[model samples]
Target: MNVEKKRVLKIFYLIATSSEELSSCELAKRIGVTERTIKSDIKQVRDFALDNGAVIKSRRGSGYWIEVFDSDKIQAIVEQLVIHFAYDSSLSDLSSEKRSNDILRKIIAQDGYVKLDDIAYELYLSRSSIKNEIKEARKVLESFNLGFETKPGFGSRIKGSEFDKRLCMLMLFEIYYHKAVLMFNHTQLMNYFECEDDVRNDIRHSFLKVLRESSCHIMDDYTQRIARYLILLRNRYKAKYYISFNPEKKVLLKSFKQYKIACDIIDELKKYGGYDVDENEILALEVFLLIWADIDSTSDLAGDYGEVYFEALTQLEKISERIRQEYSIEFFNCEWDKKIFLTGLIPIILKIKLNCEKNDMKSSVLFNDSVRLSPLSIKLSYSAIELLNEQYNTKNSFASHLIIAYRIYIIISKVKYDYSPIRMIICSMHGIEVARSIKNSIINKYSEKYFAKLDLYELYEMRALKYDDYDAVALNYPYFSYKYDWTFVLIELIPTDNQLQELYNKVILQGYQLKQFLEFFNFNKNFVFRDFNFESMESFINLISFKHGKESKFIHNIEYELNECVIKSIYNKTCILFINHQYVDHNIFEIYQLNEIKNINGEEISHIIVLSVDFNHSIKAFKFIEQLSHQLVIDRETIYLLTESEKLDNIIDIVRKGLNSEMISLV
Candidate 1:
């Protein structure tokens, strides 16, 4: 029993063995507790006696009395309790048989519909116990044509013959699945989820109905569960497939597991299937499998348990690629990941399978009291973000729909109806935009008064990439507004190297490029440079250098007139002059006055340009700046270190405009 139950039972035991008929107050004083606690203990003792076929009688004027007629049953009862707790003993080690019967009982009940957590939880066991139990359960139920199916990370189910042990397994599996799904649907995991519990309830029974209908001997019931476990492992660690859970090894696998969940998927195949699966080459294929399993697990995102969710699209490409090579099949799983957003329940038919017969594109980003939420909603939210990221860059199907849903989750996570706000921020940061967009739509669309409760500014800023701009103040007006300039600018820097939507998103490319971006800019300080921020920082630079032949995407308009009448030579290309913030700020024409204006890239660099602009200068003022013949020399790859100061934007703009002096009077 849990600690609470044990403590309560101890109090009850004291009451049961009391010799005198003491008042609850007196008993409470003796036990150093409140009288109410004594009363509760008496009631509990009576219930326990009744449950155990004993008797505990209570009198209104007197104290409570207990009459024990089944002392022998106590020993047997404890022994029975022992059976439930036996799994805990073998947790660290693998005593396979101890957990077999417990798993077997559940397996017999649910026809291949049990959850692994149920198996683990029912016997007071850990995941390893159930995992070990699978081994023994697999053998004992093998001849009976019975098998166990596990949902690893979720729960376990069973399937087999009705008259057979397998039949019993099927019943047990259903029982576990129904209970778990009920808990999942009823519990408030996601915030502001107002849709009826009935929404999920409506199809739950039907889902079980289908499971019963389709859960035949298509495969060994045990095999199906083991297969699911393998799939779970495969999905969770696609890029990293090895399954060594050593505490030290866990540290090594931490990064690979968190970001590249499918990093070592070949480990499972090598360990279980005994195939020489290549760990690295199989990463993409494993990514596909992870997405596939995620689709099955994240049914609510697509609004259909019967259909696949779009959030699994990134993996679908990997799957498509794998199928082409491994199975010589093309376009096998592409249709499912291509679902458009705002469509009917077709996008998320898996959660409420019954309501989504008709697909509708009229979907809203806001929950708006229409979308119900549960614990699984968090899972769906995560999946939606992954899917949206995949969809955003991958351009697959109606993927943006999932993005909206993901945003809704982001907003809802912050506005917890019952959960703590601290928890909300932690969960919402990863999908900040989703939260911000959802909050805004709710405030405007349905006139939600709860807008004030949300950290609207904080949420929006989280979506922003933090950086320094011209004075580092972002201008958000007309259509919208922003307090910090870099809020939008920082948007370009991709933070934490989130899961890749394609090959380029992988660390080998994306991380490498980002590392280069930081190193080139000498950006050693901490900043959240969103994708837009990285691409937008070139607003001031004049010499736009393109990588792989793309022009430098600049952000600011050139101002001021400093007729540089000079041509400075650089290492590679030809440039009129090299300049800094001071050159532009002072409008100093000394670049031409110097005997030699050496390019910084070249070995000889005698003079430099600087631009200095007042903090309040209008961007439109300095219109007479000298123009360079090669105004397109600044490469997007140029690393510009951002410093936090009042003159940040001015300094950056100086280099940006290629001004020889750092002072400028642009306004």
Candidate 2:
């Protein structure tokens, strides 16, 4: 049945079975379509109902119901519709995407040219609808370098290299039948492939057995993909369609270990199904297995294949570096992560370089909405594409970019939770035992959960220690005379429940505040200047505040604030000048390594670090800058690194580490 007729039948069944009358709006909602579409289908539904011994009754505003006269005839019609068109009711319209896939499949599956009328008749669509869907299908085919040729009487056929055709076919199968195979819905697979249960099971067994003997571990989804490819290959071969590989390229493929594995699989197929596949078919299967299956070792692929692996690794390193430079974040911090990323990336590189078809059809539908929302992921994907295109001279499809973006998002998200511990100091007037007791209680409750480090200290030691060394300071008695720069809270000697809970909340808040503060320190190379020269403080401020085009009034406000604020010199010889200002529209942080030391008010300045925060910035931003300024004054090593470090990444790393150490104080 045509899609419209099926929809019309569905509407009649709904009105016939519904207990209450359904309005056009209500029917549209239930059917997952617009009210106008429901209205359009209503006339056809009325005609269908009348032919099936029922009449659809409609009132002005009351909506639709059904009146059945011939009960037996109406019952039979409803039963047939339920059996065939019931599953389609929940689907919105026969969407253009799906219709295109159907049309593409029909043309590809045919031997020569497929008539438009035959497709329209088979799909129950009009000539016009089929033509529109053909355009969409043509775009997809063109991606694989396949051509859609249509003549007056002969209709249409996809014209491309056999390899490209198979690739397109593999992509289509992945889109349409992968889920069924994944679910082990054998009946659905059998019906779709037009194969018997025995034949399907034998093909799966043959593929798995070959993989097992070769010690190859294919992911379950990929295993299903190969099986589907084999089924399609058998059908295509039966129709006298075959893949032909280049003579030289076929010789190079035979040297790979996968070629042997493919031979074994073809041997099993011939054994079980009594069918012989050509050498080109074996080479094609080899390429499929190499792309989809995971082998135990790359040691077996020693020569040309190893060169491909190394080339992919080189491209990956460049892509990773580009991402790091652009985002100021590492793509993969560990070797294991790099290996995982490289493994996933190699197939994409091969798919592009070898002109292999894309099989991850679901990525577009799965990630289109979510990927656009993540600018970082989108940027990372573009970086990867740019690098890959530079290296291989081929552009990735939109689907490939989505897959890369999805992977990048997963890695970046995992990096977000790498938290630094919050350091806390407990002081008691009584003795060490009392301080220990308070520390133990807090640790037992919140230490592991909140990633806190608690240390016991005597109240007399408070005057001897620096407050900036710890994130929070808890005391048994209120010592008003001694000033504290850190978060301060008082408790009883034993510590009350309320006091401990308050301390826990402070620890959590301090950690969050520190994390927020550290985010501003993540500087890209573009923001870092080396050997910078400025004649005066005014020129320096203007240079730092310089943005492209007309500068906002906010930039002038920032310059005013910086000019009014004191620039403190932390060291004598290699003076690290720190300037922090507020009342800006956005947070700004930059470092300028001076070409020549300048004396300002008899203090020599070698490096200048400028920080500006929004007027309505959080307390965390203020606290972070305050703590960092204090550390630069006290910690000589940090100041030395700030003035002396030549590499931009190292400088940024040291700044982050210095601030983290001030807050965390990890033992």
Question: Of the candidates shown, which would achieve the greatest lDDT relative to the real structure?
Answer: 2
Task: Estimate the TM-score of every prediction.
Answer: 0.18, 0.57
Can you write out model 2's per-residue Cα lDDT over 269-315, one digit (the tens) per residue? Answer: 88656358789988998887766645333333325367667876787
TM-score of 1: 0.18
lDDT of 1: 0.34
Q: Report every candidate's CA lDDT.
A: 0.34, 0.63
TM-score of 2: 0.57
Cα RMSD, model 1: 29.6
Where in model 1 is the C-alpha error above 4 Å? 1-43, 50-67, 70-98, 149-156, 159-163, 166-667
Provide the lDDT at 170 for model 1.
Answer: 30
CA lDDT of 280 in candidate 1?
32
Where's the lowest-lDDT run of ten residues in candidate 2? Answer: 182-191
The clash count for each model shown is 145, 1
